[model samples]
Target: MSQFKPRRPATGAAIAVLAIALTACGGPGGSQDEGAATLTFGVQAPPNSLDPAQLHDGTQRYVWGSLYDTLIYSDNEGELQPAAAESWEYSEDARTLTLRLRDDMTFSDGDPVTSEAVRVTLERTRDTAGPQQNNLGAIESVDTPDEHTVVLNLSEPDPNLLVALAFGSGVIGDPDTIDDESTALNPVGSGPYVLNREETVDGSTYVLERRDDHWNADAYPFETVTVRAIQDRTALFNALLTGELDAGTVDETQAGQVERAGFTLQRVDGISVGQIVIADRAGEVVPALADVRVRQAINLAFDRQGIIDAIFLGLGQPTTQIFNTLSPAFVEELNGEYEYAPDRARELLAEAGYPDGFTLTMPANLFVQQVQPTITQALADIGITVEWEPVPAQQSGQTTNWGMYFNLGAVAPPSRTVALYFEESGSQNPFGTTDPELDGLLEDLAAETDPEAANGIYREINAFAVENAWSAPIFLQSTNWATRDGVEYVGTANALFDIRVFALSR
Candidate 1:
């Protein structure tokens, strides 16, 4: 979900505290009963579609996650765990993966959730070229020898396949319910909840009713769930105060205020990295940015700590590398390589033949604007002139436009993050900068089956990217959510609020 700037009054925090106090006394209302087992979540945006293949945003996943089940589970640290699949093993050559499905699992449509179903789902995912196609692109074929056995044949060894399956890649749908075109609007899966079409109003509110006979009933305890999309943060916050919502996504800046209001605060590192994406590396519009030294200078000029303290209210850590800190590939030594140094930045600029620096356009978002003054000052100290351009609302997440734009977005696994942004052949890489050196390293990293060897390759990739300044990472921003009294929501490390687990206090 995109950040929504709050227009709170000077006494808004105090008002919120008092309002929450009154809410405790008054009890629940606005469609919630006093002791009802319903969880109404005020989301930032509505689901784009019900189909898992079409889902690309967190808001959509928040709903779809409840309605679909993946083959594998992800622990908070992103380690692979068991879910639908009972156990899985790799072949001796590490080029094939075999999974054993739970014998008792069944889809919501009353069909057995078998290995054949898994194969059908994965093959369908690959053929559809869905949002998660990259996650399953390495699979050459899927063969089901029995009802409970599925073997995946890979074109090459793919270390990310398991992680991808644990994430968006392994959403299994009922083969009987899916159609070629209409599945985007209608979804059928073996998950715990079923979408209530009668009560659901597209673009405004979505209602999900729990299935009593679901195999994973222990995970989802809520009787009824309602997801209401409120774009304005102020309005969403007010709804929480007025007992209109049991939980809502809150900004990191409002963490203290939410806690002060007696609401339970949920914090996580989120799936996305916060950074300044140098989209125009080829320098079509901003010619000076084409230099590697200039990009390195830009990387060194940011006060990441200061920005986190001021804008994120000390809720985030200064990002060290492109990979999330939780990933095994993360190199601790690379954390301070681009430490804030105006002197070094100036030196790098001079080395790049820009002793007096050059002018470049920068796209500004709400959060980016908060730290713009400090960033602008640092750039000016290093003889770089920045022209701030307000991001067009329609083009919020598009990278086709030139300039240093804020990348407040999601990329699940570290390997996929590298592939998506850095690789020349990556579908998401708009600039298409060809780097055979980085490409060769990524190729090796992709094919490596040994975890330790993969980590080493990742370190080499990190060293090359840091030395070349592929992109200037700011920090991994924190995602904050707040729940009313008597509600428990365990936030995921990926920062996804899995609605399947949301439950009211007994």
Candidate 2:
């Protein structure tokens, strides 16, 4: 293994100071004991609204997930599972999906969760013009035949409908209160928890009381779940160490220190990877990146393994494909061809008519900052230089399509991941690097229904993407969750904390 020490030791010192400063503030939870009946969780993202339809970000999804139940859910293996809907079946043409809602389900306000409610909730979601409305664009219409039966009519044969529903679009809100703007702050749903409006702080802390009358009450162990917004990594670590939080997500680099501090750490293989999105592939902003050879050279320039070992502290796996290993579209064979080779990278640069190299600017984030040094040195070795343009994490979305942006997000199926970038109207593709060949492949993949044939076609797309070096696939990130001993919890491949399954020590 190649050794590389980071140039910034100040970051390390800041973390140490924050950890020590927490002790001076006194132990966390003055009245809330360590092993109390209530479970307090430290969340990095806070919910902007309680309404599920209005939510778009992962943090909001977690909070909304607690406040509402979805029609369907995905198991650890990514298979569709039932939630509010007891059973579902697809038509032979794959254009229609029928669902059977449970008769026992009821919203916190005592209103029955019926098929009509499903129609209304979904229709309202589309009409609201919120962030999640686009996810439901495939559904042409929703039909409610009876009190417990819902049938969805599709505009086209979309295989990703179930997966999208199993995610944010599937969350069911109470039809009675969904239209009210107050619902954004005080939500009522057929879920395990009800918001304790008196104790809950709008942006800082959210306290939820368990509903014993919920349909799946037996599955939820915590009587009360408290989600606190602690965006700062240092604050999260301090909270975990001082007993302010019973369970909280941690950065992988800090996992060992958290465990050494007497907290139990659980790691899950994430469906997300860290990558650098070269949005300006058309050379609109950076003239040199337009050449495919320059792009390939950029891919070959990074010493992935060395950065993984030194910068990530051996917590990450190097990758060449953007899709997670578990994704059906991910081609294992394609991952090996693009190993780090500086000499070959230099050759590619020379072949692209940039023997002297060229400089480009990229947006910086925490992850970018960590790997920037290695990237700087590796590119310099290949006669290339990069200038990082600083962008705050919260404001990073504005930087997309500007030049290049750091993309560290969860990987879904091909339809949501790979095809999402290549499709003509794809949301993720804003730079407009249009290729007739790539566009045709994406269209074919979308229309194909056979799993075997689809996977084969996807393999071609994956290989082509790697050969072109569309983006620099860094690694499949390992997410860490810290909990006190005796807390029974399991991390998920999807990276969502299913607090309904969490149980305290008896």
Candidate 3:
């Protein structure tokens, strides 16, 4: 497990004195009783809904992570570890998965966690029309052979099945209360913590108390876990400085301030990719986007390093592909495929029969407000005009009014990324964009069983996407987390934050 280390103080008598003073007070949050530790974590937003089906990634993970236990979980090293499920096995054909549960596990309400409960939760997540429903699309049916055994029958070989289960798709809840209206606010699970509904104020703060009788109590060391919704970056920074928050995320620009305040700054790189998605590839909304040269021109028009330096405060690395750097599909050479060249972009536009350039409409939302000016200026340099349409941040990505839009797509394994973005039924493929060659590659990847061979196919798909200029990816975004003196947080490479990753450093 990775541990946060204090940064060396800059050379200055006053600075050294302040660092010494902060260190003497046991860091920002002050000293705490190790035996009765309380971890107060702050997130940018509250969960949309407490229902497992309705819950999405990001802040929602901070909630569902404590309220429930997944069948399997990824450890600090990104390896799948047994959680509620003691062990799991795949069939020879890789089409069926068998899971064995720990008989000692029981829900907070004292109901035994049997195969029935697992089946119910998995089936509900699969059948529901929610964000994670498509993650389990490979499951054809769920079969319970015995009280402790559950079998998953897959329609095809899913290489990402285990990883998906380690995420939201594998969250197990009490079967009896799953459909109850109150369960949405009060969840009962066999996890290490139980929601303290009385102390939890919806949309503001959620309090979770430790369950001593939990099967794996050692995995979660906090006696109490409080997750607060502090959307404003300034407020979050203030809370961390004043010791109101034991741990919280901050913007890249504030890393120096946080480190100077005697807080351990943890960075997990390439968790997501900041990019412009050209959803309407058919040019149904923007006639100019239909040509391959036009898309290539857009890709070449952006100064990725300049954007990273200005907007991200030089905390990110420029990239030309959407795949995460840690993914097996990532090609090192692809990073330099599209260099910042406005002259080349203009040439491509002229070759595509639009020498005078064209007008492209994009959404204007608070989420992308910071980078809008830079984006507009970059495209303008290439003779393209941008018309921004004001829309609510929540409705911008869902609507088809704009031909292109800015988004931060979460980085996952190659297969999961493809299923979530490249597939016809994918969320990012809102217009059902399809390519016969890419479709063939995906089909082959699904049927392949060998890990090495599968990875080779993943690289091919990644290269194809970049070569075709399917989207204009700017850079691999980084996430920062600051923790107090006694709190040790193990960062996960993925986008979601797991509560189990925290431990009190007594």
Candidate 3 Cα misplacement greater than 4 A, ranges? 1-30, 359-366, 387-402, 492-496
Q: Tell me the whole-model lDDT of each prediction, alpha carbons only.
A: 0.71, 0.72, 0.80
Q: Give the 10-residue window scoring lowest on summed lDDT in candidate 3.
A: 1-10
| Candidate 2 lDDT tens digits, 1-506 | 11112233246677556434432332222233332356788876577677767765454565677778888876656666678887787777777888888899999998989998889888877666655666677788999999999999988766567776777678788887887888899988888889899999987899988787987765555667889987777898889888778888787667878788877777766546777666667888787878888888878877777887777666667898877777777777887877888899889888989988987776776446656777778778898777777764433332333566667766666665653455443444556567878877866766787778988777788887888877778787766778775454564665344564355533
TM-score for model 1?
Answer: 0.80
Model 3, 76-173: lDDT tens digits are: 65666777787888887888898888899989998989999999988898888877787788899999989999999999887777887877888897
Residue pairs clashing, model 2: none
lDDT of candidate 2?
Answer: 0.72
Say which candidate scores most in TM-score: 3
Quote model 2's TM-score.
0.82
Kindly list the per-residue Cα lDDT of model 1 for residues 412-468, writing each as its tens digit. 556656666666634346667778898799788866766689878877887787777
C-alpha displacement of 219 in model 3, angstroms? 1.1
Segments of candidate 1 deviating more than 4 angstroms: 1-36, 57-59, 251-253, 269-272, 279-287, 342-350, 353-404, 410-413, 422-428, 431-434, 492-497, 500-506
Model 2: lDDT of residue 208 = 84
